[model samples]
Target: MIFKNRLVMFLKRQCCFCGAGFLFAAIAFTGVATAQAGSSQPDVRISLDQAEQMALAHNRTLRADLMLISESKANEITAGLRPNPVFDTDAQFIPFFSPSNLNSDYMDNSAQFDAGLSYKFELYGKRKARIQSARAATVVTSSIISNDERQLRYQVATQFINVLYAESKLRFAEQDLATFDKSLSISQKQYQAGSISHGNLLKLQLQRLLFQTDVTSAQVAVVQAKDNLRQLVGFDSVPQNYDVIGKLEAPQPKLGLMDMEADALKSRPDLQAARQLILQSQSQLHLAKADAHPDLGTTVDYTHLAGNNDLSAFATIGIPIFNRNQGNIAKASAQITQAQEQERAAEQLVLTQVRSAYARQQSALQVVDLYESGYLKEAQQSLSISQYAYLRGDTSLLNFLDAERSYRTVELNYRQALATAMLSEQRLEESIGMSVPSGKVH
Candidate 1:
């Protein structure tokens, strides 16, 4: 910023000179402005929470699942509706071929006319059972959707951390390249002044290529990771050029392994969904049994023929000798047993996931601790000391090069350790069915 201001003042002074100088100043200022604008931060930057929320709102699959709930509610309405009444009307002895004989007196005296209404009423609480089954299925769907949301959250968080890791690696690569470039520059001057041999200078300059390659690889990794994260965040939810912004290292979780396992059992939606499935199956069995109970049909008729009027009533019921819905009842019973077993399996799965995630996070934490236990600082100090000694002719070039490589390796490893620890935290939270403690641990 200071350089930019100084350059602006210098350009203004030049503008006060010849018109040619003014034109040159204007061009220079335009170039500087373009560079500054290009280097500015991206317009779309999202944190982890923002990405997860956007995914939840805009993910097509999730929206489709929510639509199924509406469908289930509609099914409930259909189940609660009663059967429509059947209407019948007939005319005899004066059909279309003999329409001339169909006058009012003829229709009443000669022709016979009849009208009837019939309805089949549901028996044994069949309608109620149907409604209950629909409702229970809807409840199961809701829990399944909740579990899907939980999985989506974990997926988004994991990808967000991946992007963060890639960005951190890119930054570290650029810094490492710049630091090595400075060493190359010093080697160039030393070779010219005969302070260093030409062969040694060539080796230093050649090694700079490795640092440049690291920067290129890191850039590619960053782009790929961002693309993967964008798929989860929903492409339309964020701009194409969006960048992720968050801490590279996750904070230590406050909860222990046992606590995490207990929390998962209490909160994991998959377990809830599994338990709901059992109720859904039971409701379905009740509906199946209700289907076996045949409904009663009743009809009332009015007739007029030969100047006589008559009224009649009829009732009907199925014998239920065959096709008594035995298959559906048996299937529903089997489903109840399957659902019960699934619920038990879900519980065990939750415990296993919690334990595995907690173990991984703990291991990652220990790795991060090892890096922070002076190894990283010592590597940097060793490099700085060796570089100083080599430039002053107090040490050999091999010693300086080895120290530099050691420092680079250690620094990169430390960054990866931090990223691993943070990713472990994300996994642990996913398994635990809630967010653990976050932010800097120390």
Candidate 2:
């Protein structure tokens, strides 16, 4: 109680000076807040933004997606390479049985020895076509991985909100328990003084059990929420005793559905990936057409036969009478159409998401406004009045208890509204494929 009084004193005045004063105020407030929160320091404290950054940096799933990009680049190297030359040396018609008659002239006449080197020269720019297709495919893969990052960002944000909500509920439960303890002490005094009946005191004592239950339930919720967040942020990044530092309060947002859709079209990685797929398909078609033309095989050889030495060259090519890659070329062409349709679908989905998220955000904001405008203060004031009246023998026990329950319900609902509002903002940003304007932090 004395600490809260001192905290209010520190929070009350404006800065004594400029820049330095602002820094001093910030540091002082942080220290006071830390001191007020707990006797021992937490292992770590993170805000929503920090949690998102940690998740992006340490997430194993994202690292695996990045590895796919490296794999695709390696494949590009393979696609750009040309075929290796074949070398051969052979001795034919050797007379192994006639050892006595194996003179130099007989060997030359009877044996035909040859050494040859051959290479297949690709036609229709096949190697170049392969390289283009591979590079385009890599571009597509990169965009897809970027889209994965977008999804991860959304996931991290939602989980961070969950942690914040749980913490809020836990704080409320503990604070409410403390308030009830004071009330119970007063009830005991009243019972001893003959100002309240024993039965009425017992009823108030039994209600303390409800407050204790709330605290226990809230503690479990905090543990479960943190555990779920740890899985997304990476277990190694933070200790088990880590805590999130934030409050439950809604910030007003200004967003338009049409503007959000425009941003999505420009910024959405999935949409970009879909468009890249069309280019990737076109490159594949080019590679397929290149495959229809047969490569030219050329060979040069040196032969020694009948005491004469000769050098000969040969060239060969398939007649293309049976196969011309007709099926693969047709398939590649059809894939281009498929990719185009996919891009169209992606664009439509992005717009639909923007609208849905916008509507949700609006609904959440309304609830937040409903709480903030009157219900929160009204509930607190009503509970305070009832408590004062009951202790002075001016109100019934039933009225005091009713007021306390109403206050608790209002506060819980308000916290939930705050969480819903924040989550809606996250969803909206995800639909737009970029971070929106920052809101006032409470």
For model 2, residues 346-406, the per-residue Cα lDDT tens digits are 9999999988998998899999999989999999999999999999999999999999999
* Whole-model lDDT per candidate: 0.83, 0.86
- TM-score each candidate: 0.87, 0.88
Distance from true location, Cα of 123 in model 2, Å: 1.2
Of the candidates shown, which would achieve the greatest TM-score relative to the real structure?
2
Please give the lDDT score for candidate 1: 0.83
Which stretch of 10 consecutive residues in model 1 shows the poorest summed lDDT? Answer: 14-23
Tell me the deviation in Å of residue 330 in model 1: 1.8
Candidate 2's displacement at residue 95, Å, is 1.9
